[model samples]
Target: APFAAPRGMVATWVGHATVLVQAAGLNILTDPIWSDYASPLPPFGPKRAAQPGIKFDDLPKIDLILLSHNHYDHMDLPTLKRLWERDRPKIVTSLGNDTILKAHGIPATALDWGQSVSGAALNGLAPQAVIQCGSYEHCPDYQVHVTRNHHWGSRWGADRNRALWSSFVIETRAGNIFFAGDTGAGDMGWPMQARRYGPIRLALIPIGAFRFWKGQMRSDAHIGPLQAVDVFQRLGASTAIPIHWGTFRLSYEQWDTPPRMLELALRCAGIARKHFAPLRIGQSLPVPTVSAVPIGPKRCDDRAIRALE
Candidate 1:
């Protein structure tokens, strides 16, 4: 069931926060979860409303994996184990989560905010200053950067925030892509920090699980449609794809509400509807490269960008 790889940047929303990003000749999966339920127990917890877009066996060779956090829905151990045994892809996650994976016998590279791991380790060839492939020529060393996000992580109720959570900015030959793992609008400054990476080509952002108790309980760890637009505008990505919705019923909002709200929010924000793509499960869309003219004015001070580099 392997589909032909897109020649340029492409993304497929599997479900919830899981997205398959193909770029620079590398196949990367974000917060991969193919389990039937987002629970410790198979029969309990939020069951998947829809099956994963790409069947487990059908996934193309996965070169890398980006684990956003340790939440059950975002970090499914079974799926990780399966991919590990089959593909042995390099898994990148925020700090402390590596311990969780190590206990399960999965090796991962854990990074703190602003840290990154290169692709040379996963190339299966001798370390080289530059790795050339048919899909990417003169590609900069593929890098997965761990960036801070406004989110908490825990498996059990008592151990909240035991592991740091993160979003990722992947530097690829196609373009720098941002993956908003799972976050709420915290001070709204984190996205601006991410924007410093500049010229993001594709952004995978969350838009669901925001409406809790009809605003009785503030969703401190998730962003709504309007907030998603805010994040998109801050990141200044060429295209934004909405995720983390319609897969499991994890909040009070009705299923199918996120995408609908996202459309309206885009209109209100005066952003082009095509800029925010809400893909259905099992659907894949091409990611356009960054334009010659950047999306927004560069905000990162020259010194800050250099420091990040």
Candidate 2:
């Protein structure tokens, strides 16, 4: 599928954890993988259950790429190389991952949790003194913050946690966006840390591949629908779009299970269904601008709100 260039603050779910975010006049891709398989080998491992929402050639000029971890599914080297050669987008990932990317001829800036890197430096642009405001044309300075999440990173059998795993908090001119690369509900307080950065306008959270051994698995590395909603509430985001599902058969759950379960979870949590979106493989939606006006009280049932209390 080919995507039209989105004008303002917009996001497109290109399957799995891959999302295309167009905001602040810059285009960003999250955990982009357009390969046929999310495996170490081309012919083996988890083959993509569906094609990427937007074709590679159809992508607009990408300003940055966000990598959450080193899993083959999330870090497809072939696609990364292609994008690097084509768009020369600045790549950001957790610490220790930069060495891996550098060895593969792709340069990236690696940061530890709570550390941040500016897009201007990443894109090789010199710092400017004047602020020329026009649609993203002036290349507004953006900041990508490496934040903590409950996840592990490993590309091979012997290298577990050799590279750090994390989520990202992107502060753009339009608003703040949180991209949970891949995370489990760890301590239930990790999401709260993001709140200090300010109100989150959009949240991209994982909501699939959680069922293991019929619930026997600890699921300490991936989050399901219920936990996703919990993370959403913790961040106090204005809108939430569920990702990391329905693109690959990584678990025992059915292809349509995540969204269906997410709907049930949202209803049970007393959150308005409109606040949570389950986008199609190639769907793009405009994000609401963050406003200073206070939001009115939610319409959730008192009983539903009390359940969390």
Candidate 3:
């Protein structure tokens, strides 16, 4: 794992939707699951196509955990229990997910779509001027806003949407970070909700598990690379890393298709490829603080639109 970025930001793809985000002197984890199978039963469900990029035991000391929803793939009870025992990190998730965690004796803070929680050090304060943080052994201060996303949740088939689904806007001294848990292109306006928090330095967007049928690029439940580029532009993110692909066999597309399509989408949208990097599992990339100018909706020519079809 990369060393924590004390005054900057660094992110490592741990596989699937799991990302080890080192920012604001805190070691934050998103949808961390180290299980071999994303199912209620072992040796069944979606078996991992690749092992965890960072071994469970080798993870840095975690300060915060962002649990997006209750999908088996995103919320593995065994891993959560282990992390709770070892690191005692502050686990934050959408409503009703806390009930699930509570049943397993894991404490977590639950928030609604527009609610937020700040670290103890911040005393529930709003984001302030950026700080020049040096090396520190503990989290300085931060805020996590539970933002809206177009997704539903159900561990079993019957309890869909009992718990809310959401993205998150993490406010830190370094910069704001957006984590789009798992979502589809709903009104394409949710990204702007996160952007309202502040300029996003790094956005972790899902760009796979969208193809439910042959030749299908997107679905009501997930966004493909084309929609993901639109999301990136809408949020005005300085940089983004694609997730939810190449880890588990969840969709019909080839394992390598999402990133390839993302490359194409970036070119079609006239955005630089480096802004939306797709890293190898366990690869770490330093996030640079860049100016985030608001961009309008994408307008690809007829030929460009047909090429994505």
Candidate 4:
């Protein structure tokens, strides 16, 4: 298809942390990691049970790519290479990952969180500064601004906190969308994406890969189903499409547990199924035009968020 504004953005959950977000006449892929195993080695690391919903070859024309962080799941080098080879679409991600991409021959533009970069997919939205509260200076490579998140970001070895990892509040004229890479639900900024970035029409959030390794639940890794709901409400998203679940069993939760738990969370909160519909792998959903659906707000308490314990 010839390039055009995404009449509206449609999110197709390919699996794990990878998602295909088509918006503003642009087919934008977020962390397009289509590899069978999310590891540096082909047979090691985690394996996926379900295949990618949209085969690499069958993808619509990709205009842009968003990478939230550089964890292998969100920044698979092999997948990025394939995308670069196939479409050569412009890629956007956090800094340092550009080195990885360039190493793979994928020319990409990397940005820190809160930084705003716009093109056709953004619906003609312009660049905007982000609300930040961190010790690190925002990298200069991006045309966008960088904001802080309550998560950890480190690609390799001792430099875990050297480079910042964060969520994005993308501001486009058509609407705003928040893409939370892999993050736990402990931070206050989790909800601020909507308040700070404007109205969040769509949220591509992480809803899986939360492991209970070592008995103590890690607050910086990723959030579970209930926490995902908290993120939706916090971000003031009109509607939400759940990702990072059902594709691969990255954590201890049953492969199908995330969705079932998500429904239960919504039900407990008194939210209608329509308010936060979780898409099937590779399935697409439209961005909700209505902000704050009429579905009465559900009773999501901090206790419920803590229930993941």
Point to the candidate with the largest TM-score.
Answer: 3
Whole-model lDDT, candidate 4? 0.68
Q: Residue by residue across 176-207, what tens digits does model 2's lDDT show?
A: 99999999988988788877788998899999
Candidate 1 structure quality by residue, lDDT tens digits, 1-309? 223243478888898999888886778899999999999887999999999999898899888899999999999999999999999988999999999999999999998999877776545444454544434323326878899889999999798988999999988777888999999989888787787877898889999998778543228999888789889988878798999999998998778777877766665566777788799898888876675323333344555334222
**Candidate 1 steric clashes:** 0
Full ranking by lDDT: 3, 2, 1, 4
Task: Name the candidate, 1 or 4, with the larger TM-score value.
Answer: 1
Candidate 4 local lDDT, residue 14: 84
Tens digits of lDDT, candidate 3, 60-167: 899899999999999999999999999998888999999999999998999999999887533333234224433444335788999999988999879988998899
- Between the candidate structures 2 and 4, which one is better when assessed by TM-score? 2
Higher-scoring candidate on TM-score, 1 or 3: 3
Stretches of candidate 1 above 4 Å error?
1-7, 121-128, 131-140, 216-218, 292-309
Off by over 4 Å in 4: 1-6, 120-147, 213-218, 295-309
Judged by whole-model lDDT over C-alpha atoms, candidate 3 comes out at 0.88
Model 3 CA deviation exceeding 4 Å by range: 121-139, 293-307
Native-referenced Cα lDDT, model 1: 0.83
Model 4 lDDT per residue over 1-309, tens place: 222243466677787767776555546677787888877676987888899988888888675677767777777888777777777777776777677678777886677655656452222332232223111112111222334556676656776865556666655444666777777877556567545757778877767766666554434677877788878877778878888878766778677767777877886778887878877777777666746755566666777655544
Displacement of the residue 257 alpha carbon in candidate 4, Å: 1.6
The most accurate candidate by lDDT is: 3
Tell me how candidate 2 scores on lDDT: 0.84
Poorest 10 consecutive residues by lDDT, candidate 2: 291-300
TM-score, cand. 3 vs. native: 0.91
Model 2 ranges with Cα > 4 A deviation: 1-7, 125-135, 216-218, 291-309
